[model samples]
Target chain A: MARRPLQEINAGSMADIAFLLLIFFLVTTTMDQDIGILRQLPPPVPEDLETPPVKKRNVYEVLVNSRNQLLVEGERMDIADLKEGAKMFYTNPNKDPDLPILTRQTRGAVEENITLLQQALVKDPKNKQLETDLKKWKGKLSAIELIGEYDELPTSALISLQNDRGTKYAMYISVQNELSAAINELRNELAQDKFGVAYSELNPSVAEDKPKIKAIRAVYPQRISEAEPKDISGN
Target chain B: MSKFTRKGKKGTPAVSTASLPDIIFMLLFFFMVVTVMRQDDPKVSISKPNATETEKLEKKSLVDYINVGTPIDTRFGTEPKIQLDDAFAEVVDIQFWIKENRDRRDEAEKPLITTSLKVDSDVKMGVVTDIKQELREAQALKINYSVNKGSALDNN
Candidate 1:
């Protein structure tokens, strides 16, 4: 009365099982790569506060309408040419001799003026005379200095973007991307010229060259100021 | 002739399957490594606009997505809706969502959180602007507009 030995289960079918699972995953899996234009939103303005006026020459105004038309600096522009136009406007390499030079001294004077105005306002919050003077000095300090003698620094070049409320989100984002590209393009060019390195490689993670990269960024900072959306009819 | 026929007649000796599991295992690992389990199944239809100047989102963990488009489900109707995580949300819900996401991160990593807006290209700018304002109110200043590469969209 001998009992038959138990038969070993086949391992051969394991491959088939694995293949089935693999195929299932292959069918369901998606390898989507996320990519996009990065931007920082400006701080919310207080209801009672006023946005200081930007001198016409210093502002690189870009407008997008509901139809996705681009109006750059009051001229109808094609979306394809936006990057080059923005770059030229911001760099202004061919200085206009009539424009005032934005030197270290001028910046210092502007800062001093602002501080004095702030102190005066604090002392006499309700004084009409001080308030008027404060507003004037504030405008001067915040003015975009367009110097003909030197290349316009990024700090003084302001990009003002406005869009119609009905503008497509795509167009609005595209414009922003182009403007950012202009700034980044300038920074990369400067980085390559000065440090012989690509701008992306000049990041702070590259500890040895961080300072040099920081200097280059300072020369070509991104200064996009998004204005409130205007009514489509106005555009 | 008969001896030569016997050698050829062995009939391929039952093709060895011993290594079949190993080969399958290798394939399994390959798929596992390449697969990115989607965190959220988009309920809304999204066709991102093409753009020339896009950078690959470097840190995946630091990004939280907000999808804006008309819902795919008929139940939700045709009006454009914002999808945050798993559910439909209003623009105002963005503030709390951002705060919750930020709080979940380590203190040092919280500042690096970026709100990735995956808005359908056809959606009006007004909706996106509202979301941006909400994000600003929540102090989530870093934002990324998700876009496909121009060439990729063209190929499609």
Candidate 2:
């Protein structure tokens, strides 16, 4: 005898269940991706070490008062002009006497220094300082290899960012953003000029782009020194 | 005699919804994949300042957020308060929070964790400076200042 036709299971409730779940997720979960300005804080300073004096020309001073006014390089300026001023200070294109000095380093000079450091390391064998110096010179040699033989490096330029205690967080971030933008713009231009690619396009995580990114970063290192906030507001 | 006769009493056929469950399931899966679960309900209401040079924070799991702003409850007063996880905290609590969070992570992932500071725009820098000092003391140096993506001019 033939069996009776089997009945189909109802799936009408399945859609309702899925809709409920979807609504729950939509309400509970945040869709906005977290984006931000990345920064690395300097380690706490030791009491014994004295602060090194930076040359006046090498320091690009950016002061933000509590009143949200910007004092850039001893000149009162608007927020919009800060990026250009920073770029000018960083590049020092005209070899201005007031701007940061750009020292040219030849490949031969870097290699010679590396060899000397290596010889010194061999003799001491346990000198951590010599080892670190050797590693640094080797890094410089590789960076020089990537970009041409001789390059003018901003060896001592540092952007000093000082803010008042009463300074608004918004103004502080805006200043920081401009400083980062200045560095990024310089890197972007250099990357485009050297590798025919934007700096943002080269990811350090990728093997091939690692050296390119390194070379770019080595040429234009981010050297923003944030001073401890004081009552710079002059209240 | 006709081999087949036409049926005349039939009404218009109802639309088939056999694939409705499948469509809803697809949407449900999409939401599930993209959804980032809310980890902490911020006690301090933060309206992040705007910045031009913003970057996407990769690996959300590796980021611990520290919210700073005016406390939502007026009973705490108007001063900007720091929020560590779900509850309001002081500047001094950052070190302990960092240690606790770092200890929870795997050994290899400890150094890779980032601290994202979600500070309000109207807040003063004094509180932020205190937090930074606290972070530096704790040796949690890698930080990201959470900001809205906008042009620098917009900030002015």
Share of real interface contacts recovered by each model? 0.69, 0.88
lDDT of 2 by residue, A1-235 (tens): 9998999998899999999998988878788888999999999888698877778998999999889999988999999999999888877889899997787778889988988888887889999998888887777788888887544555667999999888889999999999999999999999899899999999888999998898888788888989865778676
Candidate 2 residues lying further than 4 Å off, grouped into runs, are A150-154, B1-6
Error of 2 at A214 (Å): 0.9
TM-score of chain A of 2: 0.94
Best by lDDT: 2
Best candidate, TM-score: 2
**C-alpha RMSD by candidate, in order:** 7.6, 1.9
TM-score, model 2 to reference: 0.95
Encode model 2's per-residue lDDT on B64-127: one tens digit a residue: 9999999999999998998888898988999999999999999999989999999999998888
lDDT of 1 by residue, B1-156 (tens): 676565444554677888999999899988988886678889999999877778888778899999999999989999899999999999878889998998899999988888899999889888888888898889999999999888322311
Question: What pairs collide in candidate 1?
Answer: none
